[model samples]
Target chain A: MKLGVLFSGGKDSLFACWQAIQKEEVACLITVVSQNPESYMFHTPNIRLAALQAEAAGFPLVEVETAGEKEEELLDLKRALLAARERYGIEGVVTGAILSVYQAARVQRICRELGLWCFNPLWLADQEAYMEELIGAGFTVVIAGVFSAPFDESWLGREIDRRTLDELRAIAQKYQVTLTGEGGELETFVVDAPFFAQKIAIEEASKVYRNYNGVLRIERAGLVAK
Target chain B: MILVVDLCYRDGSLSRDEFVAPVERILCRAETPFLTRHYTAVGAPDLKSADAAILCGTALMDTGYMEQPELFRWLLSFERPVLGISSGMLALAAAFGGGTEPCCEIGMVDVNVLAPDPLFAGQEVFPAYEVHEHAVRVPGEFVALAASDRCVQAIRHRSLPLYGLLFYPEVRNEWIVERFLGLAARQSP
Candidate 1:
């Protein structure tokens, strides 16, 4: 009667978990943390606050630390996913894989190895529709990181909105950045979502632009219980 | 035909992170104006489910689907449309007609092509950015759209909307990025 959802604190993962709570019964959320300075398999840096995300989703959090290399990271993830399935006695694995086969294939492989049902409710949906859904569902997300190109310091603290979406779309058309940032042209974090039990409240934040690398870096993300 | 090179692959794994840029380059370049997901391997994401799909390249060529062979089989079943570049191109070549052989490896280079095309637009030959080692031998039925002096650079299937290429058109300069995306931009997602 329970399932484990991969929680990323992004529009897709957060929304996936919310849908699981509504459409199926899920007990807890499992996330993987690769502490390495550069991680290929994990979401982003400073997600240590995922504990905060766990609290908001009303689920327990479990994370596995990864070090060195993507294959190694996937191996660690497979172990964590299998252990979570066993320890939680969960019947299914829920994912937010809309387009990337990299994450979906790995999750499916792990679920198969773990003998659990794999559910990707958002799989293959239209990117525009998904973005509209995130906004329509009341999720507030912001840009978190940017490579020196495509986007720079000016993009660091930008909000995800019609204008930002428009910019991303224009950039994709003009420069080839996908609307979803799936290609790593950019990445984002959701500050709040429709299912949040408590909104993530930041006392104050600064968009410190790293001029050399020149990115608006977000720091000091804190959560407040509703 | 479209070519996407995923920087997320092995050698391109700058400081142990790759796969993302190459795919991002193609998607950003393609700007298909649709929701996109990332799949671990060739068939993992089930491209057949979408109205149209683009396959990004990989780091190293692996054995079989890094996820499932069924997904590639599913893709071949699709008559709608699909674009494959680099590793994606190789994977689709195997699925639609037959196997792939080694060609120019990773990194940037100029590509030469011949013949008129649906995807390539018009021009005798153009310099598309290059990546990947695999060269595919297209089925006789699939028309060869573009080719370098060394190999078959691009191919389109006779009966289906499927296309594959050996290079990375998305890796071209910014103007080409917009121009390439313009092909699919008007179509509804």
Candidate 2:
């Protein structure tokens, strides 16, 4: 199937595209950049870097803007999907919606109305196992933001690996949080994944931690040969 | 929070959040705490502490699907306010003597409210996200609450606080979830 992935430059979405490429043809990457920092739907952290990620992966990228108001932002995504369908002849739109029905259901609804297949390759996946699979599949993902207790400022920009997974598991068990950062515990960014022809090199970044929440702002980044 | 069981197939196609995250967001908005478990972890004993239980849908089960025999037995015997979602609705139907027929819905479906029920309060037509290849034919004493052109979309037991919905309530259907939470809270000991 020819498809467009709802890319966020996050581990889950990148992995979703990687997995989809194995079975289907990924035509482009569709990204909805929410102006609302606290957008209820789309991920905001490290979002500007999505274009670079798309370039590294050698897929055309579509960027749409939304005010990110609760239900209204879905329209922006819909517009992006429609454009992808018309421009690239995509038959489906895939997302890395591991566990957010708030996100997945809306995408599915839009795809349905537009006659596009909605594929959530990471839907209902075991969180811990999914994280492991990313590392095993040679995806270098890192923490981009942390929003809750037990995930302090130190977690920002930390690479997710076997040890990190173990620590995350322990914290999750202790705090009853999701191992894969579901429930807004944290957000991730993909530095390198198997599909990337090049890796993202962060030139300058800063960790902004305040009021019990923090994010790693990527000031400058460029794609370098892997 | 309610206990949502992740019933997706384990072949790496789907994740638990396809079930857990949407419901979790709803409950979080309602200030409810939800606990998640794999379908295999849901023994009858675990059901004791939960205020309610939700069976989640799966991608792999779009065709013919069946639960573990013991799990089916336990679900049949479970006496609580339960909400069956998508594939979960099929499990409920099968457990209650109803069965699933092959269906091919995979997008937004408009289900007209046939009767007034707590889950569909004040809503005439509930638009829900559906991704199922089978629709539940509800059993005896379970009234149909809503339907799309294709099949029955919602069902409820006449007496007990048991409900099954082919439509995903976790997606833009907070009323359905809030109402179910209200029923669960009222019924919980």
Candidate 3:
């Protein structure tokens, strides 16, 4: 099956893309840039950097712009998927929905309406195995945004490794949060992955903290040889 | 009053909570009270005190039986209402002398309910999320309740309140769990 992946420059999306490549032909990576930071549907943290990530991974990427209003942004996403189908002749779209029914159901409905198959390899997948596989596959994931308690400014710009995963598990157990941060508890960025021809090198970044919530901004980054 | 058994493949370093989280959230949404236990502790689960028990899915198949022989025996001897899902369904089948056939059917597949059951109350046919290479065969003591083109999707004991499903109800929605809880609450003393 030829498929388009909903890429967000995050671990879940990229992992979904990687998983799809195993069974299907990934036609292109689709990224939706939202203007509204508080958009409920799409990921806005470090989203603009998706272009560089796509370049590093050596995949064709298509970008879509959305005003990011709740419920309204889905239309923009639909338009993006449709465009990918028309341009690349994609028969399906893959997503990295581990535990978000809100996002999965909406995407599934859109795919159904568009007559395209919906693929979610990470849906309800074992979080531990998923993370282990991601790491074992040589993907360097990092925490890019923190939205809940038990996570302070120090958590910003932290690379996800065995040690960090252990700490996150402890914090997740204590706070009763999703281990994969599926409940808006956190967001991630992929610096390097198995499929990448080049690796993302973060030369400059900033941490923006506001009222127990914070986001790590990638002010500058470039792709370097792997 | 519900018991959720985490049927995760114990690798000695991971918590099975990730597999149980969806079931937890379903109970939370339905306002149904429930308790959770790991598969290792299934040997002596407090089944008498709970209204029902649910065996969640796992990534590994051999991890289910090889890790806990006593638990498998307990489930075979269990008389209370039990629901098995995916690898859980495989465990139930193994305990009943029925074995799994190596036939992979992963992803959404159409399922047809052969008879009226509480788990699939209102639905006659629906799409289910399947992720298994081995499909369970119907034991003599149990009857097949639902089936897809490739495999038997569900099974039920002849006289006991036991059920097994090859699909994950926690995927698209928790209607299956909600219905099971309703039946359980009514069956509770």
DockQ top scorer:
2
Q: Which ten residues in a row have the lowest lDDT in candidate 3 chain B?
A: B9-18
Better of 2 and 3 by TM-score: 2
TM-score of chain B of each: 0.70, 0.89, 0.89
lDDT of 2 at A88: 95
Q: After superposition, which runs of candidate 2 have C-alpha atoms over 4 Å from their true positions?
A: B1-189
> So what's the TM-score on candidate 1?
0.54
Residue pairs clashing, model 3: none
For each candidate, give its TM-score against the true structure: 0.54, 0.64, 0.62
Worst 10 residues of 3 chain A by lDDT: A100-109
In order of TM-score, best first, we have 2, 3, 1
Question: What's model 1's overall lDDT?
Answer: 0.62
lDDT tens digits, residues A1-226, model 3?
6889999999999998887777668899998899988886786599999999999988889899999988889999999998999899998788887876568667766776687767666767767778888889999998999999989999999999999999988988899988898888899999999999999999999999977599999999998988
iRMSD values, candidates in order: 14.3, 5.8, 10.2
Which candidate number would show the highest TM-score if scored against the true structure?
2
Cα lDDT tens digits, model 3, B37-146, are: 77776545376566788888764322544346557677766677888888878788788888778766655779999988777778899987766667888888899999
Tens-place lDDT per residue, model 2, B1-189, is 488877754432334445555666677778987787777667655777787888877653232237463465566657788998888787877878887787767657899999887778788986787777678777996999999998999998888778899877766676787888888988888
Residues B21-135, candidate 1: write the lDDT tens digits.
4344445445443444444343433443345666665433333343443446756666656677666777777776567676644334445546565565655666665544468
